[model samples]
Target: MQKLQFPAWLKAAYGRCPDAIPRGLQSETIAVEDACTRVTSEPVRACNAVPPWSVAARNGYAFRTEDTNPVPGSRPSKLNSDSDLLAPGRRIDDPRIEPLEPGTAIGMNAYGPLPVNADAVVPDDIATALDAIQYKRVLVRRLLPRGANVIQKASEYAAGDVLLQKGQRITPERQAVLIAAGVRELKVSKRPRIGVVVSSYERCAPLGSRSCWQTPDACGPYIRTLIEQWGFEVAQIEYISPPSRAGSTPQALHEAEISYRRRMIELAQRYDLIIGSGMLSTESHRRVGLNGLSWFAASSSNDEINISQGPGSRFNLAVSRDRSPPRTEKFEVKDATGRVRESHSIHHFDRATFVNLPGFLSSVTVLMHVLVRRIIDLYEFVETPGPCWEIGELARDVECDRKTNLMQWAKIVWGPRGEPLIDPLPDQEPHRVSAFLDADVIAAIPVCRGGLAAGSRIHFLRLDPMRQPAAPNCAIPQPIEIITEAHHSTEFESMQPQMNIAQSWSCLNAWLQSMPDAIPGGFRAAASDDDIHVLEAAISAKLPADFTASLKTHNGQVDQDGVCFEGESLLNIKGILSEWTCWRDVIANDEFEGITSDPDGGVKDDWYNLKWIPITRNGMGDSLCLDLDPAPGGTFGQVIRVWHDDERRERVAASFEAWLCRMVMDITGLEEQKEQKEQE
Candidate 1:
């Protein structure tokens, strides 16, 4: 073998290897219970029908639909309640079994199979006793629907249908389904074997280092543990030191590298994967000329292992030839077999001393994980043979009457029957949406050092749902509508003695007032001081006039001093109108509108002819934009342009307004508020 200096780069090693190293293994069949975590080796098929036989669908008695013959004074004989309806019954033409009146004694039976030609079998409770007849009298109250009592055979599935396929993991429900289909065994692909190579100097402690721990050995255990968790067996992890310098020749290191490579190749044949642990570079033999083999191969090749596809692709190359010493000049030597696998012209430098090995290795681990996960996904696609169980989300139209609790919100995905056939599990639905927005008395911290303890927070919950942003067609930004401004309170925001009663009253009153039409017919609002007892008394009285007068006269603003005005005040009117200017600017730029109405009645018309200045935080403190429909809906804000000079303020206002509009549209968007107009 030729003596060579190992190039000290980790990328060279990675480039020479494949990303998803192929595994050649056979498939095998296993029972469903024994196949957990195993990849499917082949697609499975159903062996039998799902519901194999006709059986009782309910606890009620089964009888022929024609049993309800309208013959009076003729009492058809009855059978024992415990007897199967399918068993031999008095024939429809039997002389002894006379037809009974509409309201006569009928035998009671549960789980009985219906007899042929019998129209119906009414339960005992439905039939009035004619002479208190015993099990001998047959009676019925109503006609039964055809095929109502029978659970037809093979209703779910048929035999010889695919149950599962190769490269798929079996889930619990899938197992049950397979069982129902009469599948006893399943074939699965062999688990991929992985060899983890941790090439690092820390693996084996050098002669001078006091730390006896080998880096490769220490890291190997952790790597193996993680790999096993991913459902793969970890092969052996060994540590190697820098080649010896005793012989002043590259022969020793060459032999070691060849030995290690050959062992790895052998292991690869048996296992799906293998990983080596040790520093691929050579900082160990600083006093000697012997370097690592990884560096040697890198030095002998001109091509770099580092490729464009992240760190993992660095493992897919041959060798690099370009260097100062020109590795080509020294590569004419032969291996122990008298043949060279690498190019003859490349010089083989010591493979030790590769910098950036640690970071590169870490990145390699991440890349490998990604590749493995991708392989799992591909396998799943190929293995799942049926209509690939999928989750479909659709908006279940709910009438306002059904909107009672959180469960109804869930029923949007689930059916109205309350059983969640496809109900989105809690916390899995679109973001965290909750009905109760906690209320608390919020107060500002006193600037004085003599700290006044802030008021205790009193949380108030409202019966509302959390709102989310909506699609473009509704003309409202958010799909969900929050009828009230019930904000989240944090300790940081409230530092003073928060008035719980006042905050609670404010929120409740605001919510009530906002939903003017939602208030009950006889309900009224009244208020006095911000006292719980006083508020409760007013609620009992249901006096709206008293509440309205008391809040303005006694409770003061009942709002955050700096909070944006939610009322129909002068500030709000001015703010909304001013915001319109900004909206117009956005519309002009985005080209969503052709003209914007200005406060001066000037239609800034022909947006197509104007150039819009792009607004960004860097260029200015804040900017406005407009979102107007090409058509009109008679809603003022819907067609209005809005603006806020402050970014935070703009975001908050826009978000809230979007929600407000959606709520309004969900309610009044359907029709004009006639009663509202009359009151106004």
Candidate 2:
């Protein structure tokens, strides 16, 4: 019944694995073009300097800087010119070309290496040619400063400079830089091989099969795909079917244990990591006679290590085999004197990391994202933690046992104040694989007594498949301050009844004018009564009093500033009407007729309700609307989100006035914070 905190468990888990790029992981030289996403095994240095010699940056005449006066309106500087002008592709060392003299100039094409002694170039537009009896003279009207219009030698990078450090992944941008630095090949770590093991008591069936009591392996293929996406190769996906007999006899259990151990040993010899999902509980381990296994015995107090996160609470981390002969590998390292020295690196291999995960699909997903992904990142030498975490406010109260950390799948919706609201999905019962279908992010709720209440700030990791690891400076968010409605009421009362919509509009407009950068495109002219009436007639919905007054003050933004609200553009009368008509058309066509709204929120059940009028857009086919027709137990005139691609509609505010009041308070509160910081 004892639980090991996640951080301590993670530390212990890391101790079992080898340092990054173990000796067993051999290095291979690959073409620079094929090095994207591969970690460098050794530091890569530039083979040659970029722009080996000074070159003209533009089509111009190259000449010495001292030969001409750089002041304006001065007599044109005269310089002797060769009969045959220098062109691109002509070698600067050609024997036919004379050395550039102080008073002589040479016509050179862009990117052409400068002739000897030429320090600057005059663009062709400012230089003219004059015919003379002895030789042609170039009369440059404007003088160019020294090194002007020239790309200096070794400006970008010098030969032997480190282009990429060890353990850095070659991104597309980095690859381009490496190619330009004359790096043709890179020594990168070989992809780590991973093995996925799914343990179950029931008979496994193929997906979509209707056979009796047969179910598909939910964690196998999904885990494989995740590992592959992270650039690791899944060598094999094997299933270990423990004896299904009730109250398994000791002999049967012993036989199952032998089979399981043999399979694990085989996988450990081949793979860098072994991920086992299902049958991680002590009872399950005992039933399979795996209680004697060293890896299973390392669990805290009990056979299972309870990580403070839910559905996936039961977990285990151990090294399958840690005793391996030290292997020595040679590496070319740069010495203090910048000379390459051959050094021997001693490391141990044959120690495959083993991670045991809970059986449920949701648990598998949570542990994979939070735990397994971290393991892969360490193995692959991923510098940044990847674009994983996003900040949002909890949409509603989430109750938990408070004994462990909770991992909840949530759908993201933008609030009226432009803050992201995390709406937890209903089907959190570990077995519901469908819970992940519509989930946008996985909210990591820290261990707390009464759980997190609505409007509490929390950070969650994104589940976006297309996201690439980036931003080395992205730090993991710290635990949030648990906020309950009762505790928040005091803070809310201090800012209430401050300003009405019309007054707030005036104050906001003044602030915007003071800070032009706040709204790049200024506010549009106020809407006329006729325009408002036209919009009402078009949408066939009456505009709320507060919304109508705000429109009269300013129709909308001139362009999408995304400043009116966090990342939304306030819609004008015409935009509102257009958006309404479009949604109405979608409804008439029955495009999403059977779809329903989120059951927990105060929004109506219909996917595209006719009574919802859009007031702002997030530029991603999602909008914040005024809900004139509210569902049962919902407030009329509430602000809600209507997503074009999702079926969730969430109520954000009680009314337009309430939303504007909060927006104003947020702006003013930020200003106050800034003022205090400046004073400090």
Candidate 3:
């Protein structure tokens, strides 16, 4: 199997941060009123045309150009020589508004549409006939322009202009634009839901029963509070206690690993990500926290952790997972002395991501912020902002011990002049906790090395990563959804919408039904219960319901000549088996490695994990499949397309049904295809 790899540069930067999380939810829509400050998960468009119909721009008198012409100001009330004037009993020929004879004027309020057959509005300022209109005589003024003082249809925008785009944060201004475009609702990313697992050295008798001895505060609550400020949903804090505290037996301690493992799995089902604290360090002899995670993955070597562990080595050991037992009876553990220490149990994890951070209140806060912030960015597939490292001049001399020890992150704060200033926080010492409490940002100094002059520009992040300016809902290349009611109605009219999914699917399916030969072999018939069970066993995963529904209709295959998707054959059960087996063998033989942590790629690492199941392949060897294992914070049952040559994967849609809808839309166009069919 190919070895999963992370770019050396990124690994260095991430420190102990894991690569990816599993997905548990999908994008959802909420009313615009409820979406302010939320990030959009998908692009939204104008539903109706702006200025649905032509209307008056301001209060004015409505009339045709010919009616505004001079007609001998002194002409008799009953008749004129030219007879181009209103002759009292004559009927107007247009149906738009109440018909009136030529020279008869119609009054219009601001923003009102002109009466039928009327092409222009003469504003009170421009009419010049306010006093002479009661009688038949008309005043002569400069010829008025047609279409004057009127708002034309589609003046602001057509029916399908994009109003909101994916990854854009909604603001009041954007809300106004959405309202104008008839967007009453929008799709937005859900907040990250976290399952926190904290390890206590000892278990308490019961909740709120501990003696009130004055001791330092626990860091868990503070971490929880800080994360909440980031707009994430924080689940109840779950504590993993040592076996002695729980049952007081060797067997109980031994069983702790299994119990916590079960808990982690259970938590995984409900949370986007799981965080374990104090597991890496010793916690009451029960292997409940980090040790349990390592054993679950059966890891063998921890090179990455060793490098990032820095100065602390006595209690630190990297745990890796292995599918088989070690060859030697004694396992080698890398130590701070640059040598291996032999031990019975090995430390390392391969699949499970674990990071060891000091439990110091300040230390934990800094690390947690970095780790959580990165994960949030990754979950939404957004650009992970980098640290704003700059040369910072220390206001005072920062000093540290000479012995190489734990990495000390000094607090940083913005100076009076908006300059970044670094403040020294005591290293691994509790008495100097004041430095942490008063600080706003943090900067790390080299382990075992510390002595700085007052003036120095040191590397640091803004506590938060540096954010680059981005255009939000400004210009979009293609509109995925549009609100037509906003565009079709007058200023007073609003479009009432149900949803867009049915319409998109109905349109695509209607076109497909029109062309019987669109799919290869005319689409296969639905599979039986026995067939579905067999297929599920063969793939080792329950198929997405929507995908299975489509398969029952066709089984994704082609036995005949004609095809639908660029001559690519949808894999039948047999074809799917063949491809799956080939991949298994390749992975077994170390010929094809799956995934480590890939966030930069549109497709996340979960697609390459064992949980993902392949569904189809193209003639080019590229495969399209379903992600059974999504990131802890990702949407499951999502479709991913993996390219043949580079193994680059791209997430296409949230579910099989959505994927099919997108496929039809992509093959044609999301809205344009339907618009065309409607036109036909």
Candidate 4:
């Protein structure tokens, strides 16, 4: 029987399909600073020439090249050595502002602005070359060129020159050019999101059934790592170990097909590309059949390894938009010699492109390098499309016992001479998970040929998923606000010693004022400063900054549905005083065992001490309190929800400000904030 192959099948498919690859990628604006390794969607041109002026290239004295002629042997020019020629405050007036004629030496470096009249620059070492007499006179040893030691305007790039070209990655160097060009924004190819699935027909047999679904050691691990390193996102990639009778009964196969088809279409909806690996039914882990390809049971996916049409091809390129997948695809299976063995039809999506890799060693070997790599290249616009093979001599004897015509791949590794030495691994065999480990290079052994020697030269690409550029991570700067006069005045007024707490209730009132539809009327005004002062004196503890800040602005509750365990309202100043007394009466009899769980982990000490201030009622016979054990110079303000059992005290925030911010977010924002700042 003749050998079966993927490349040939792919070629046939390509001949039947359109030559043009379908549209897949889209363009988006990415901050120039956040664009390292990102491909340019369009050319990034400079708005203005770099430097904008001819400037000195080094630290030296600028002067007329004409006067420096025959320097060591000629009379010293009368160029004034007056360093005072520069303006005060480390600034140099543009030469246009103050002209300097020949013989006038201006001291400057690359960092300093160019003077309008100065031409060449003599290095500081010019002093060493000259005698003591010439040194004192600030003279040079030779005549310099017209633009010597000077960086001419636009020398790097002029206005409208491309700083970053389309299809190019913004590497560190390219990023620097954009920065120098003052291009803070640009367009980059959007990173494609991918999804991977490993479906097992046996999966129908209840989950965790004898671990038949054991994950492959080398399966999608390297693929995912490489894709992520290329800056593409992989939604998920998993391995499902072999087994099952999905092929036994037509009914079982039907069920499997239906189940897997639904799964594929669902994932296709969410990911740009889908690479699904099937189960390892055969011992060699290669022969793919209906059970293996059942994941896309309705699609045109045949259990054949055919990614060589690669990513730049029609199907792969469809990732940018929709692939317009056929709702169902028909497949006819042929024996090795070309006789039809079976015919089947499977469900496929109209938009998702799915690749099926059968459970075969040789198949994995061939597709892993060629196809997967092309996908990454197309996704990232990685300029280099591959077949970058390297030549190397075999260090050891190669075993060639096969008599079949099937072309296969064997894993190889490098030897001492920098040449990739073949460390031959088994091929086309069932489940050679061992080969999946400890190998890098691959060598193709032809039919009817056998080296069986130690010095035969073999070719392979030195491609290793580990060697690609790691994903680029650029940090974003948070916005910082500058304090305005209004802000300063507000702070000053709010902090006045004579001001009563009730007088500064604008903050809470203002917040309430803006939110009328808010859980109506549970909140009220704060107590007077004198009243709060009396409470503080009784507790002998200072309130946290955030707690006080909120009280000044929002000292009341409005939650009718209740924000806690029961329908308890947020406490106003008067409510707080009342809640404080009721809590005091209970704690007087039983020991305070309130141990609040810190959001950052561990227990907060003495959480329910009399020092804690009340914020709201729990209605479950407990109240929310603000712990205010001021740090020597700091104010205490951690929010804690407490219960009477002296148990289950949950610390909500580190400060009142944080607590208020969280509450505001809860009321207006969608999620609760739980920030754990990492220790430096």
In order of listing, the candidates' clash counts read 110, 2, 48, 30
- lDDT values, one for every candidate: 0.35, 0.69, 0.52, 0.52
433: Cα error in model 1, Å: 34
lDDT of 3: 0.52
TM-score of predicted model 2?
0.55
**Prediction RMSDs, each to the true structure:** 27.8, 18.1, 33.3, 27.6
Evaluated at residue 434, the lDDT of candidate 1 is 38
Error of 2 at 118 (Å): 4.8
Query: Which ranges of candidate 1 are over 4 A from the true structure?
Result: 1-25, 66-80, 84-140, 149-151, 165-167, 204-219, 235-248, 275-365, 375-680
Better of 1 and 2 by TM-score: 2
Candidate order by decreasing lDDT: 2, 4, 3, 1
| Candidate 4 lDDT, 1-680, residue by residue in tens | 11212233344443322211233445799888898868887889997678766788888777776655443223334455545556664444333314465666776766465666677776554322222344434644334557778887788889899876677666677788888887889988876566755554432222334455544334455556656775667765644333344346887766754664565556666775666554443444443322344344334433343332212121121222244644655679999999999998755333444554444434444555656655544555544433244455556777554443232344555554444356565543544545445556545443336645876654544455434333321212233454432111112212323223333233334443543423345364554677667767766776655456556555566553344212346776667777777767767877555544222222244545676677777566677677664223223665566676655655555555555544443332112111112322
TM-score for all models, in order of appearance = 0.38, 0.55, 0.41, 0.49
- Specify the poorest-scoring 10-residue window by lDDT in model 2: 484-493
Candidate of highest lDDT: 2
lDDT of 1 by residue, 1-680 (tens): 11212112323443233322222334677787766556666678888776653345554444544444434223332323323222346424322233333333224244333333333444433232332333433333233455654565466777776766555566556778887788888877655445554544445422335355543244356456655765566655544343343554587767866665554334434543434333332234322211222333334542233432322333222221222342334345568999866654433331111111122233334333423333333323333211111122223322221211111122222333322222212231212223111211111111223322211111111111011111111112223443343233333222322223334344334443533322222122332344424433422322223223333333322221111112111112123234334545665577544443322121122332112111111122232222222222111211122223311211111221342333232232111233336778
Residue 259 displacement (Å), model 4: 2.8
lDDT score, candidate 1: 0.35
Off by over 4 Å in 4: 1-21, 47-59, 66-74, 82-88, 92-102, 107-116, 125-137, 170-173, 201-218, 238-253, 281-350, 360-366, 379-384, 390-448, 452-458, 464-680
